[model samples]
Target: MQGFHVLVAGVEPTARQSVPQAFRVSEVVALDAAGLHLLREGDGEPRATGLAPLPCLALFATPKTLPLMREARAWIAAQAAAPVPDVVLLDRKSPPAFVERTLLENLAAANAALAGSALRQARRVARLRAEVEMLGAVRAGLDRFVGETGLAQLKRVFSTATPDFETQIELVHGAPLRQVLPVAGTGFAAIDLACTGGKRRGSFVARLTLLEDGEVLAEWRVPTPAQDGWVRLGLPVAHAGLLRTLCLVVEPASEKSPCANLALGAHQPLPAAQLGDARTGLPIAPHSLAFRLYAAVPGTTPPHSADTLMPVAARKAKPVPYALQALPAEDLARVAETDPGTGGPNLLFVADVAAILCRPGAGGRIRAACPAGARGLMASVGVHADTPSAAVGVLGVDAGAAEPALQRVPVSSGGVEEVSLLFPEPLREARDILLSAEAVDGAAEGAWVVFRDLRIYT
Candidate 1:
């Protein structure tokens, strides 16, 4: 046997899913994904019935968690080898084993063809009209060739695999798993997947890697005749939000088994950076932003609010102004302890293109609109989300001063983007207050703080 057909067994208590199942040391082991299936002796061999003998692997599980940790060891006592692999390869079952046959048979044929025509000088091309084609054992044994290049050339030698082998692998690996916290996780729990497969379909391969930024990169290759599902893979890519998209690629491979792992080694977090158009010292047009406001003065600011509004139609190009403003210490008038700014007195949350949307008013107090409809007036920070992970911003407003109240300006389209300091019914003065915008948050760095379009009612 190439590898042991592993299984696990166990039972759920009458009430709780947590709290180990009552009694016994050998109740669960092998043949199940979650260590919850019951395998029994039917017709002389083990057969699963979801009742008596739950089947599952004892994967470093607490002996308290496994009723069968010891007995299951006794059961598999004969075939015992190295109990654990440096890496465990997990797979869902294939249909009637036909899918496995298809994959292996293709591999066999591919190997058979390679011994003859692949080394030929003619560079002959052949088409794989068969969907269940195998690309078995691409290359090894050649001392001069590295594993990847030989495989790539082998794919080229085959000539007829359609969207190409590497591409196909990428396609399969990219089947979107449910999003996870991206940077760190141990198993599927890092994602939003159910413990049991929901009507589980087809077979796929999973490969894991780690980036410098502590993100666990799970690259999966899923092959099927037709695509209809995306099992969630748990990973979150910092501010780079499409992290799940990066890890999972869905592709159409005829057979069910993976010939080789689509090992995408050492993925790095997309470095958040600034893009200057040259010549101008002012930050470039930012993709998004995140900014924060620190309330300098201590008073009943009544929880200030701060959210961004996308103004329509920017003003015509204006000449860039010169010389950085001196640290306006007076500007810190209403503020308390201020953290030394990063992103060069701009970006927040680190290394990302961002800027500060500082609105310093009345004693250095910054009233920012909070996220999730964070009502009331308070200090706040958030993204200038034209896209995810692309920005940062900070607002500086006055809490002690009674001037800038909350405002609900209506968009021309009739929806409200919620501008601040426009409440308390004194409509005229709210609009007249000297409102200044600037780049302070590191993430929203380089955004052109131009006067853009606005059509507000309240």
Candidate 2:
């Protein structure tokens, strides 16, 4: 029977054999006083004698053995480490059926409580590990930046540092939002916009474009911010001379939900700076968005163009294959192996490539050293042909930064689709890059999502 374990401490040989048959127990272990003493010691030596560290229920055969069980329970309680097993005294007066029913109920409750505790502990550990890694990445980034550009040369050229906002513009899909501002100085390298009301649901992409004199200077595609704060986008073009007017365009790449709001200041008619929609040719408001512009000091080099800019779609680059079979066993366990509600692998092969299977409530993660000159990640994601429900999978990559590059794709049974996401910054060293996948739909009977052909493109 599929049930929890029970420890029959100091039980007779005949009684020990009957314990498993009396009730639905996966295992019934018998132990003497010496073994009980070993358990109290907490040295884990009882495991060698076929004893589990924690059992759901413990039964004493007679009143004589009750004292030892109580002592062990007290010791465990004092330690405050493991859960104490439910103690039961098996006397001659009690009926066998009643005892059996009570034991089963207790076992179920104990098992549930233990499972919940373990899950909480695991989540805590995972969260702490992520925080530590984030801190380490921040330290590494600061060290690299300061080492390349001296600390004395780093300065903010312009900033609106205001807490009060006149109005807020809600960013939507296909609206073509633009912020026009006149530039009177050179060496501006980056822009930071104050934003609010961004709550991540599935996955969304936000594009930032810079234009001057009707010419495209640089463009960037980043994951929509999951929180409300200042969003920074680095510019790669060199501003060698004074520019007359610069236009900043912010828009959604596609029809995605849950977008951010740009904070705007009070209207000013003299500066000729305003917010408007490029499609309608009408101004939304006669105000400039709250933003900060950063620039490099004289004699210091600006951010490199090749490293910060996203590569063109038509550019030729070699793909470095990352084999799934080479992953360690522990990493493999994090992903779903068997098909949902079935024992099969739910194998799906596309172009002779094996796909990794995932289901609702189950996800996968892969960690590897960042390849030299790596610019982006490419992979194929889809649903199996026999899938019973529709699925949407969100793929993300973290290069040890506060924000991860993200992409959301709908998985269909008809055919596989490919997606490519560029990293925010190019890696200079062999830092670890983490790839993650998870289903975002609310289907209880989730479909089989498959991923294959993962590679790094330079």
Candidate 3:
């Protein structure tokens, strides 16, 4: 019979000694209730180390350790990028034969499930590739006759592209936020903000104000909803002159009001914005509130009417053939929250180029506008030179509308691996791409993952 590894937690030494000889048992110290709570909340220490080649079975020998076992299972689920291990509760009085049989059955089931998932993922990737090829052929035929410019014009006319501008990252919350919009065209009307209401019961009012050059232009007050989601405040601007710059501010009625969470984007210089208490006059540099400006057509039947309201483009257009390291310093500042000691994602230099350094359970989402004719994405993942010889980890890549692609890399000290993933369809618009990493089977401190040279390819 082949030997298998089993992890035993909250099991007495005498009980652990009774594990079947066909299994290699490793003991994990049980975390107390407080410690387990903190771990679940992402504030505690890293997982217990030294058990490598991740075990096939996790056994909890006491009912008191049920919470710990559940926490472990939840952690494994959170690492959606990696393989899952089977967790079981073992009764101290259960027979030896019964325990052995149960372990084997569970191991068999887990392996079967993993195999099925892989098959499905593979089939999905194949279908996506086939569809992409078909689309490419069709586009090529059209381009031969109509030409690239004509084709683009046709797509613009037929495409149901909405002019709604919204940010992808909502990392910051609490306090009031403001956005400064640079005005160009005429017929500016209303603004719709992304807001969620709080649970406290009260007659709180949501105050939205529009200001220009230290003068209040327009203001609207609406009762704060007791529910969640976007709250649209109509800005009734009466000015007919060309407005140079407009500042939009959102806040609660009073301090006793229910706290509302307004979604905010990661800070960027353009579309100048701020978030913090307006009273203190000190802005939080991390976030800018989400807002959508609407304007009526100049020659409309009734100027500034609701029926003529169209979403105005607020954000700057992102460049094509997007490269992660090529982003501006201000944009890259919000890329990842780097803290190596706490296992957060970091930015480091790898082979004389900037790369994203991630510990286990750390990852980030990046938003990019895919250029026309873009078909796939390519990236390089590796381990730092200081990594241990036996370090191993998995990197997961997920493009919009496609199944996630996972690569398991074993770095003997320092090694680099290339990862390429094809989009499910030809991408020509903005989309969010997610990158995650996990320490599959290695020393905790040694399993650092480095990602660099990210490129969207044609």
Query: Candidate 1 residues 1-458, lDDT tens each?
Result: 22122232333222112213331223233445332343322334444433322222222223343444444444444244423211111223223343234334443554555565565533343344232233322211121122111111100001111111122112233342211113222211222111111233344443333322424344444333233222333222111223231122222233554332221112223222221111232323221111111111111111111111111232221211211111112222222223333334321221122112332211112222111211222112332333222221222223335644433221221121324332333232222212233333333324322111111211
Instruction: List the candidates ranked by lDDT, beginning with the highest.
Output: 2, 3, 1
Stretches > 4 Å off in candidate 2:
1-152, 161-166, 200-212, 241-244, 297-458
Give one digit per residue, the lDDT tens place, for model 3 in 1-458: 23455656675555666666676665444444333221111235534432232444545446776666666556545544545465666666755666667677767876787799999999999999999999766644433322211111100001111222343222222455455544533544455555555455222233433444445555555455555544554433323446456666555556666544555655555434555444354565645566555443321211122222222222222222222222222222345432344543343333334466665656655544234445665566776645463344444444456665555555444567777666566666655445556555545564556766555544
Better model by TM-score: candidate 1 vs candidate 3: 3
Per-candidate Cα lDDT values, in order, are: 0.26, 0.53, 0.48
Ranking by TM-score: 2, 3, 1
- Each prediction's Cα RMSD? 29.6, 28.3, 31.7
Which residue pairs collide, candidate 2? none
Shift of residue 428 alpha carbon in model 1, Å:
23
Residue 66 of model 3 has an lDDT of 67
Error of 3 at 26 (Å): 99
Q: lDDT for model 3, please.
A: 0.48
Model 3, residue 316: distance off in Å is 34
